[model samples]
Every structure is written in C-alpha cells, then in structure tokens.
Target chain A: MYVAVKGGERAIENAHRLLAHARRGDQSVPEVTLDQISEQLGLAVDRVMSEGSLYDRELAALAIKQARGDLIEAIFLVRAFRATLPRFGASEPVDTGAMRVQRRVSSTFKDIPGGQILGPTFDYTHRLLDPTLAEGFVPEAPATAEASTAATPRVTDILGRDGLIEPSPQAEAGASVGDLTREPLNFPADRDLRLQNLARGDEGFLLAMGYSTQRGYGRNHPFAGEIRFGEVEVEFAAEDVGFAVPLGAIELTECQMVNQFKGSATEAPSFTRGYGLAFGQSERKTMSMALVDRALRARELGEEALAPAQDEEFVMSHSDNVQATGFVEHLKLPHYVDFQSELGLLRKLRQEFAEANEAEPMKEAAE
Target chain B: MAVLAHAEAGEIAARLRSLALPDHQDLREPENGLVMLRGRIGGDGAPFNLGEATVSRAAVRLASGEVGFGYTLGRGREKARLIALCDALVQSRDFGAAVERDVIAPLREQLLARRRKVAAETAATKVDFYTMVRGEG
Candidate 1:
C-alpha cells in the first residue's frame, strides 16, 4: 500500500534547466555536432544502437550527445525515441553467408577458405597510450590485395558438410516467429526467443557470464569457430512492391562458437555450435553473447545447470539493462509513507522488547 | 531500387529537381517508421527477430494512374518522397527513360563509387601469412 505525495514541480523544472546548462559546458568551445559524434565517437553510438535494439546511427549519435556520453542513458533515450515510430514489417532474414566480409578470422582452423583476412583489428596492437593520437596523426595507406571473388563459406558450414558438427535445428514450416517486443517472455522459451533476448542483452552482464563459462562454470570447451564483420544486404518483401527489393545494406558482426559435445543417447558425437549477431562492427559483444548462448543451452545438451550462466530464467530476467536500471533507480523516488510505516513498526517492537526485558528482571528478582 | 535506398537525400533531391517532373500527389505521406530485422540461427538455420531499424517510406500516385512506393533504410523524409516520385515516373510511358537517365543512373553511380572506395580500403587490410617450419635446424 502507498500514497502519492507530490510537491517538486518547480524543483523538477529547475533541475531540467540546470541539466541543459551543464550539457552545454564551455559554450566558447565549438559545440560537438551529431556528425562528429557519428564519425568520431562511433563505437559509443554502436553500443547504444545494439543495446537500444534500434539501428539508426544518427539517432544514436543524438542520444549520446543528449546523454553527455552516458551510454546507458543514451540507450534509454534511443529506446524511448524508437517507441514513437510505427513498425513497417520484419525484413527477410539477412543472408550473412553472402556478406561482403570486411574482417574475417577463424581460430579453429588456420587454413580455412577465404584465408583469414585480418581487416582493421586491434588484436596485434600493443597497449601503449600514445600522446600523438590526441594531436591527431594520419597513418600511411595500407598495401592492397584483391578481395577473393570466391565466396567465403562459413567455418561451421565446412564442418557441417563432413558431419563433424551437429546440424542446425531445422525451423518448423508455417510457424510464426517469436517477437519479445510484442509479447511477454514465458519461461522455457524456445531457442528463437532465447536468441532474441540474448541479442539485446547488456554487454557487461553477458561478458561476465561468458567469462564464468570459460572458468569451468558450465564449461563447454568453446573455440572461436569464426568471427566476421561485414556489410550484408537487407531485403524487404514489401507487399505493395510485389517482390522482395534490396532495402539497403547494414554492417553486422557475426560470431559462431564450436563447442565440444559429448554424444547423448539420442544425439550423435559431433561438435556443437553457438551463434551471435549484432547490428554493427561489434565483435566483442557478439563473442560474449556466443559464450553465454552456449552456457544457456545446457538443458538441451543434457549438461548440468550448475552455474549462474546456465540458469536461463535468472540470466534472461536480469539481462536487460533498461529494466534493471529502472527498478534499481526507482529507489531514489520518494518512499516517505512506506518508510514512516516501517519506522512506526520498529519503534513498537523496541518498546515491547524493553517491557519484556523489564518483566524478565522482576521475574529474576522473584526467583 | 537499391540505389534509391542507398543514395544520399541531397543527391536524390538535386537529381529529381533537374528533370522538371510532373506534379505528383502523395498517396501516403512520407512517414518514418521501424522495421524489425531478422537473422537465421546459424546463417542457415531458424529465423529470429534481430532488432528494429529506422526506416522512412512514402507512396505517390502520378496523373497517369501508376502508383509508386518508396522505402529507404533510414529517416530521410525527402529522399523517400523523391524515390516515390521516381518510381511513379519510371512506370509511366513518357517519363520512364528521361527519369532513369537524369536521376537513377547518376545516383547508382554515386552508390557504386561509395561502395568501391570502402571495398578498396577494406581489401587492403586482408592479410597473407607464410609459415616457417623448423625441422632439425
């Protein structure tokens, strides 16, 4: 039970004004434009776009500027803005197999097809803080190679061809796909819903959970099957258009994990796979998602659900940072009436205890 | 269609204006919206809803009774309208060739050029490794 006490109208108004003022600190310096944020602080925008589940780079940049670089707040802003728009329809599932792959690497095999292109990675860089970067420097142009016209088949596909890996579960024909945004998540959710939940789950939370899996908590002997960052065409089958048209291309990072699978009675002795896909060049997030995804598959694989990462209900419920922040941040709201009731109860209990202690002293004297 | 979705709004507007196209009415007003993107589970597996992307679409009708629809992947209101206008023109007998030559061909070139530049840059980063084996060295 609760009562509403409202009297912060002016204070709330003034606080907003103060926030606006603070956002535009040192007005003498040229204000940062959305283009600058979009181009320069691009990774921040990507993170917000991924977590917000909205793929508008410009809007994400605007949110970042409004939130003053607070990414979670920026994600919240993007989510709020996205709700105002009507949905057109779901796109044709993007064909990553035909992606114009920019960066592709396979840890499982050194000599895989398309020969391991290390496109614009920080993996080889020494962790040195360079002062020259602050001053701005342009590195020399890189030497060129002809991009292989040969299609880069997925590492998983190669393994699948030889029956070395468990086959991907076939999708049911004529079954409607699940959309969490349109419906509340019911427990024992199917893989489709689970994948969707994990797709938008917080990077940090998933990262920790993923790391836990590798540290022997629900370990699956994971290997990076392949990580690819590239542009893939988005096809939309608009009814009015009368055919599927090329909507546009969007950058996506895909991670496939090959995990060791011991054969169950009904299953074959073959390697298993976990998958992750994200909106932009977000390899780190995708990798983390893949690890947690495998961990969450413990039940289906007949593995013991002994770790936090393996607990699907616990993991999925707490995965959303937006929901977590809202419930946690609501503590700052006025709870004076509730607190007063608790305070009154505590005082009464103390009084009763003191009276009981007094009676105990008298009883001891009588004894 | 790909060029229309991928081209710059400013370029699309400039191209459309140069043609002195016939007046058009909006069948559907240019409106921004969302499209939920999807992905297959293993790139060859079950479909799952990935995320929503910002989109703007418009429908236009020409005087010649041909209806045109335009859908672009981002929030470009004017771009969607211009694309709609072009779509309608392309369907009409009189203006189809003229609109293609004046508007779409150039825009397609622009899209191709943009893609090529990025492709070249990305291709330059592709690596080639040579192994050194030590056998009783």
Candidate 2:
C-alpha cells in the first residue's frame, strides 16, 4: 500500500542524531585526537590545505575528523570556514630567493647551484609493502642533519643573467589589484589574477591538464628548473613600521620550469619560465601547474596554439573543482520537471513519426 | 475635455521636473494646464520631454576620480538630481581615475570610523563574543 510519508523535519533531526552516533563509533575504543590526525595523516592534511586554500593544519585536521576522513568534504569545511574570517590585509610577497633550502631538485641539469637536496621524498622508495606494518608498527625516525647554508641560484635567474630567458618585470607597487573572490571573473585577465586563480584551482583538474601537455597535446619541452619544499617566513607590512615584519612561517612547495622559446622577427629568442606554488608538499600538483603554465605561454613562445591545454579560456574556465563538483552533483537533485518535458517531446515525436509513416506509402516504400 | 487638459499639464510638469527645471505656474497653457518653459531661457535650458519612465537617475562627479550614480524606481526629481550630481563627480576625469583611493578607500575609512565611534559610545553595553558560545550545543 502506498501511504503518504510525512515528518521530513523529524526524519532529518533523527538522521542527524544517527550520524552523531556513527561519527562517535565505539566510544570505549577512544577517539582520535586532532594532533594525531594532523601529524600522522600529514599528507591528507596537506591535500586539504592545498585544495581548501587555507593554511591551518589544525583546522584541516578537525575538518577531516568531522568529515570522517572524506578529503573533499574536509576541504569544503575548511573553505566554508575560511570565507567567514575577516580579511585584515594581504602579506608581502615572500622572497623565495632567500628561502632556506630543504628539498630542492632539478630534473634537467645533472648538477645546478645548491645541488639537489632530495629531502624527505619517496622517489627512491620501493613499492613493496612491509608485513610488519600490517600489525600497526611505529615508524623509525631517520637521522637528521643541518640545512645547507650554500645560496641556491634560481634556474630562471641563470637564464636571465645570460639574456636567455625573458626578464621578470616589476609590478607597480600598491596597485589595487581586484580580489577574485569579491569580483566575478572577466576575460583577458592579467598575470597576477591568473596566478591567483591557478593557485586556488583544483589539484586533479590542473594535474590532468598538465598531463595533457606532457602527452603531446601542446607539448613544450620543459625542464624542472627547481622543485623546492620548505618552510618560508610570511611577512606583513605594518603602518607604523617602515619595513615588513615576519608574521609566521608556512610550509610551501614551489616549482619552476624552464621551457625553450623561439622568438619571431619582432621579438628576440629567449627561454621562458612557468612557475607554481602550493601550500605543503604537493609535488604532483606543483609540477602539473608548471607544465600547464608553460603551455599557456604559447603565444609568448611564438608557437601555434592548437591544443586544449594551450586554450587559456577553456583551461581556466573549467579548472575550478568546486564549480565542477557542484554542477555535476546537482543532477541528483529533483530534475523531474526537465525529465517530464523531455518525456512529452519524445512521445510527441514518436507519435508523429508513426502517423507520417502510416500516411505516406511512398515514404515507407523508400525507407 | 477638462480631464484631458489636466492630464496634459500634469505630464508637462512631470517632464520639466525630471529635466531638473522649475515648472513655471504662470506659463501654463490657457486651453490646457500644460506648463511650458521657453527654449534657451532658464538655467536648465534645452528641455526635452521624456514621455514615460518608471525610473529616476542621478549622477555625481566627485573631486576624486570616482563618479557616483544612483537610480531608484519611480520618479523622484530631487533625489535623482542629487544622485546624478554625485555620479557626475565620481565619473569626472579628475576623480574617476583613482576610484579606489578617492572613493572606495574614503568610503571604507568613513564607515569604519563611524562604526568605531558608535562602539565607543555604547562600550558600556558591549556584547561579548562568548555570549553566544554558552547557548550553543
């Protein structure tokens, strides 16, 4: 018997109660602390921070716990929370040249200035799973050493010094660059706006687009100039102080790629650079970002842009994970109105076809 | 005929008001009450009639590079004139060039200053952030 079901509000409240119970499963087994998740599940925390566009590890850990380890859900929580925070002011751009080297590597050169550190990477690790780890074994700490004091010159800097790469232009100081969050995106965006959009873009989407470039779709021969992961001092300018003061330190992954450029008659041939930076150790995202960046510089490189990766509008417009996920998931919502309209159209078309077939013997014979 | 005469005069008066010109009472047409202003006469010269509009507009050019404009539903001549003046000032070459510094910056500063002043005046009755925390589950 089809009985009308009511009490939607009650059902929702009861479901919430059930969820609370489920989230606090096996209370006697002890709940996982935020610190444990932050430290132990460090990679997950990093991914959340990278995607969430927020640098709070503790909050990210809390979000993960609340979301029951759903990374996207955790990211959503962090992003939603970040929106509520009052904006005081923007921090001064960090001088990456003065970054205290931790893990730095270049795939192109055998040896560059500030020789590749390869710090805390799983690059050489074997894929074999350890049987001992199956029984919940504690990890052994690796021997620690002091950071290299030797100054690492940027790959682009070397090219710039030799007039091989395009010289970086200085942006006008104190220019009121419009905030992306506040304003809707318009076409023909400046480099600063593009970089800001890319920084907060979805990792997977960027990775795929970046991958396409490597797989011969707008392929640009890129050399990993330098990929570095380290803690950088974040500074903000104070009204009273003439100089900027250090606010705190944040862990960042930065990647710079040097690509070959063929100049045209009007322009001189020089090397170009693609840059990417993300919060925490996200090498894949950073590398993909760099490749995509290089592909986007096709016009500057004097290359015929024929690939999807080279299309700035297509890549930037579709790269947002939040918008993509929202629209994709919204299909699950009530679409009966559209479905009914489509159903009516299909029925009418079929009936018309049947009537036409019956009426025209000549058309039927031709078919 | 009387009703039509009254309506025509009312429409003319409205148009004159919209153009930011004074409606002369004595200059009303004898056959109809339509107020007429002579061309090239008053300060608000070259009056052109707008048959109908549900909106009123104002433009002002500020001293800064920012031009301020206001539009509201329904005809309000004075309000529209004030808004238009503000918009004209804002859109003026001198003020419009540095919109952020001249307009938005000052506006934000003024708002913040006013809020602070109000807060100070009501400091004794200030509500604590923790007040809501106690009520939360």
Candidate 3:
C-alpha cells in the first residue's frame, strides 16, 4: 500500500541530531582541540585562510573540525561565517617592503644586499617517510643569529631602474576602475579583476593552468624575479582620527615574475612582470599564480594572445571554485520536473519514428 | 511592535544597519497604489503598472560609502529610498557579512512571524460556526 510520506521538519531535525553524533564520534576518545589543528595542521589552516579570505586560524581550525577535514567545506564554512560579519572599515594596504623578513629568496641574484634567508622551507628535504613519526615526534629548535640590517631591493625594482621591466603602476590611480564584484563581469576585464580572480582561484586549477603555459601552450620565457615571505604590517585610516593606524601584522607570500617582452606599434617593448600575493606561505600557488598572471597579460605584453589562460573571459568567469562547486553539486538536487519534461519529449520522438517507419511500408519492403 | 516590524525586514536591511545605516523609522500602509514592475525595460528603470503592494525598507551607512536604494511593490517612495541606501551600503567594502546575518536575517524573520501571527488572529475572530440537527419532518 502506497501511503503519503510527510514530516519533513521532523526528518530534518533527526538528521541534524545524527550528524552531531557523527561529528562527535566516541566521547571516550580525546577530542581534537582547535589549537592543535591550527598549530599542527598549519598548511590546512593556511589553505582555508587563503581560500576562505579570512585570517583567523582558530576559527578556520574549528571549521575544519566541523567539516570533517574537508578543506573546501571548511572554506565554505569560513566564507558563510564571514558573510555574516558586519562591515567595519577598509584597511590601508600592507607594506610588503617593510615586512619583518622571515623567508626571502631571489632566483635572479646569487647574493643580494640582504643575504638570502632560507628561513624554514621544505625545499632541501628528501621525500622519504619517517617511520618514527608513527609513534609521534617533536621538532627541535635550531640556533640562528645571522641577521642583516641592509634593506632588500626588489629584483623587479632593479630591472625597472634599468628601464628593462615595466614600472609598478599606482593602485590609487586605478580606484575609478569598476569592481567586478559590484557589476557582472563583461568581456575583456582589467588587470585588477583578473588578479583578484587569480588570488582567490582554486590552487589546483591555477597550478594546472600555469603548468600549461610552461609546456609551450602560451610560452613566455619567465624567471622568478623575486619571492618573499614574512610578516607585514596592515594599516587602516580611521575617519575620526584622519590618520592611518597600524592594525597588527599578517604573514604573506609575494611573488614577482619577469618575462621577456618585445613591444609592438601601440606599445613599447620592455620586460613585463607578473605579480602574485597571498595571505600566507604559499610559494607553489604564488609562483603558478605569477606565471598565469604573465600569460594573461599577453595583450599588454604586446604578444599574440592565444591560449585558454590568455582568454580573460574564460579564466575570470570559471576560476571561482565556490561558484564552480555550487553549480556542479546543485545537479545532485531533485531534478524530477525537468526529467519528466525530457522523458515526455523522448517518448514523443520515439512514437513519431515508429509511425514514420510504419507509413513507409513500400520502402521497408524494397529494403 | 516597532522592533518586531523592523526585524521582519531581510538580510539586505541588516547589512545596511551593520554599515551604520539608520534603522527603518516605521512601516505604514502607503496611500498611493503600488507599482508592479514587469519585464526589463532597458535603461528606463523598472517597468511597472498600478497594483497594491506591502512595502518595507530601511536606511544606514557610515562615512566611507553611500547607502541608498529601496524595494517596494507599491508607490512608497520613502521605502524605496531607504532600500536604495541599504543597497549602496551593502556594495561598499566597509560593510562586512556580519551585518547581513545579524541585523538583516533576524529582522526578516520577525516581520514574517508578525504577519503570520496577525493572519491567524484575524482568522480565529472571523469564525462563524453553524451546527445542524437532523430531524424527521
């Protein structure tokens, strides 16, 4: 006997209870603390912060725990939480130049003014797994005191001094440029929108796109002009005070790529630069981002624009992981109404074909 | 009652409030008929005709940006202006998501709850029971 099923509200409430139980698991087992997740799972926290666009590591750790370690879900949780936050005020741009250097490297120069501080990096480590870590392990601190007082000049800056690289344009002058978030993105977006999309884009997607450029898809002979990671002061101007105030500091990774460019008629030939900056120590993501940035600037670089990476409309429109994931997952929702319409059309088509075959008896007989 | 009515507004209004936009002063049935917007009419603003509409709107903004815009089904110019201001504030970077969640969502919920409460009360009072007894003629 078919009985009408009701109690959607009850089902939802019960399902939520079950989910809570599942998330908690066995009460006897030691619960993971937010501090442990933030400190121990530092990379995960960084990923969440970068994608979620929120700087709070503790909250990100909590989100990760609630999401069962699903980074995207954690990101979604952070984004949702962030959406509810009230508008405070806009912070003044952080000066990366004034960063308290922790890790700074330049591939273009062997020994720059401020000696290469290869702070804490996995670059020289072997990929072999350590069996001792199975029983748990703690890292010992290294004695370090080779500080340099010399200010580090950006590699691109040096190139700019010689008029080889393009000069960094003032962002304030570009304030009048329309924001993509405010208005729907039209074709041929400015560099700002493109950069914004790249900064918030899925790391894996950007990685693959950047890989394509290196493989001769949209080849631009590139060099890592400079890559720096450290703590930078974030300042904000209070309307009442009429002066900018420091709003603590944040760890950031900045990458600048120099590419060979020969200008055409409308523009002058100069060494073009691709820039990438993220919230934390995300070198690979930042480098890939820089490469993609350079590739996207093919038009401005006076090079023939030819690759999916160079297609501003395609890259900017499809780069958002949140939007991509939502549309992709939304297909899992009930689509019976649309399915019924499709089924009706298919049945009608099949019947028409059958009738047409029956009416062509002479043709069938001849065959 | 005013607070409840204010809460009935949606996340958009809350967002504006977070940006320091003024809370909506009051909501009243507009004397003028509502203008129901139809299909797109290019840059000629919203296309619409005369109709009855229940409109509510609020306003708020801080120094950094302008908050303007309002939504209404009726010809409530005040509501529309308030909503417009809210929209402007939401678009500003100064206003974060917290405003949308706290002020806006709660207000909307309250408004909806009030409407439902009023409707139920009116329905209960209008009840006219009729009992009939069957008998042999």
Task: Work out the TM-score per prediction.
Answer: 0.97, 0.66, 0.69
True contacts kept of each: 0.78, 0.00, 0.00
Candidate 2, Cα interface RMSD? 28.5
Runs of candidate 1 with Cα error greater than 4 angstroms are A264-267, B135-137
Provide the lDDT at A64 for model 3: 95
Worst 10 residues of 3 chain A by lDDT: A238-247
lDDT against the true structure, each candidate? 0.88, 0.60, 0.62
Taken in order, the candidates have interface RMSDs of 1.4, 28.5, 25.5
* Local distance difference test, candidate 1: 0.88
Which residue pairs in candidate 1 collide?
Answer: none
Please report how far candidate 3 places residue A335 from its true position, in Å: 0.7
Model 2, stretches more than 4 Å misplaced? A1-7, A21-29, A239-243, A265-268, A357-367, B1-137
**Model 3 DockQ (Cα-based):** 0.01
Candidate 3 Cα deviation (angstroms), residue A101: 1.6
Q: What shift in Å separates residue A222 of candidate 3 from its native position after superposition? A: 1.5
Question: Model 2, A1-367: lDDT tens per residue?
Answer: 1234455788789999998889889999789999999888898888787777766677789999999898877888877876654443455565566665557777766567766676667888897888998767987744443334467776667667778877654446655544466678787655555555666678888989888988899988888887877655554443333444333356677788787776778778887777777778888888887788778778756689999988888888887677777778877756666777889999999999999888899777889
Give the top-scoring candidate (lDDT). 1
Residue lDDT tens for model 3, A319-341: 77888888899787666677778
